[model samples]
Target: MQLPGDPRIDAIAEALLADPGDDRDLEAWAGELRISERTITRAFRSSTGLSFAHWRQALRIHRGLAMLAEGLEVHAVSDQLGYGHPSTFIAAFRRVMGTTPGAYADQP
Candidate 1:
């Protein structure tokens, strides 16, 4: 995956990788990086060929899979991944992986 070359985006990626459960949004990152949210949006899309929201969704789903494999409960994984609702997380996981977190986790 080709991440944006912008330092701000890089910082966000590092932060997300370090803590995938972070609830930080573009505004938070913009303030932290001392840039405008619009800049982050444009820069992110320009370099990654994906919107910030789209990228973050993929990141969260990817991390969620690992957490599930680690034996984390669905609700706990949803919360740890900054999901506001377990149902939302479950839906996203199902959409992306074609299986619910519980089913995936049950797979040996």
Candidate 2:
């Protein structure tokens, strides 16, 4: 998806794209940007067509695909993306990609 035009939203998007494993919540970002958390939440949904938390999960899972393709083990990718447990990462991956990380990596 293209970056949203709002400079503040764009800044958040760029940061996440650069570091998808950031794991920072919208409240933290809003605090850093000196905006109300509600403003950030509304702007994020309006600009991206996705709530901030959902977008961040999608972004992390998308990045996980690349890592898996590059031969990273599921546990390794999960750890690198800041998942506290491989099972959590696997569940999120399955939701986004319709397959477990190991299954995805085995695709020809």
Candidate 3:
């Protein structure tokens, strides 16, 4: 994933990449980084070409792909990605990957 050049945004992205389950919302990150939430949101959009929420969701889905490739179960990947429910994760995975996790994982 391309990170925004802004150090604050880059840090948040790096942390999330390292642990896609990092669960820190924009407000939390902004509070910790001592910046206004608006700044972080703008930085994410301008540099990453996506809003903060979308970028983070993409990160989680990308991580889910790797987990699935490793043979993890759909529910497991969903939990690891911090989805409150497997169905929610499945919906998201379907949205990005065009199929259910089970179906995707079954692919050669």
Kindly report which residue stretches of model 3 are placed more than 4 angstroms away from their true locations once superposed: none
lDDT of 3 by residue, 3-98 (tens): 668886899988888888888888899989999899999988888888998899899999899999998998899989989999999999899889
Ranking by lDDT: 3, 2, 1
TM-score between model 3 and native: 0.93
lDDT of each: 0.85, 0.85, 0.89
> Model 1 segments beyond 4 Å from truth?
1-3
Evaluated at residue 92, the lDDT of candidate 3 is: 92
Ranking by TM-score: 3, 2, 1
Q: Quote the lDDT for 48 in model 3.
A: 83
Model 2, total clashes: 0
Residue range with the least summed lDDT across 10 consecutive positions in model 1: 1-10
Write the residue-wise lDDT of candidate 2 on 58-91 in tens digits: 8889889888888888899998887899999999
Model 2: how far residue 66 lies from native, Å:
0.6
Of candidates 3 and 1, the better by TM-score: 3
Q: Quickly count the clashes in candidate 1.
A: 0
Better of 1 and 2 by lDDT: 2
lDDT of 1 at 20: 76
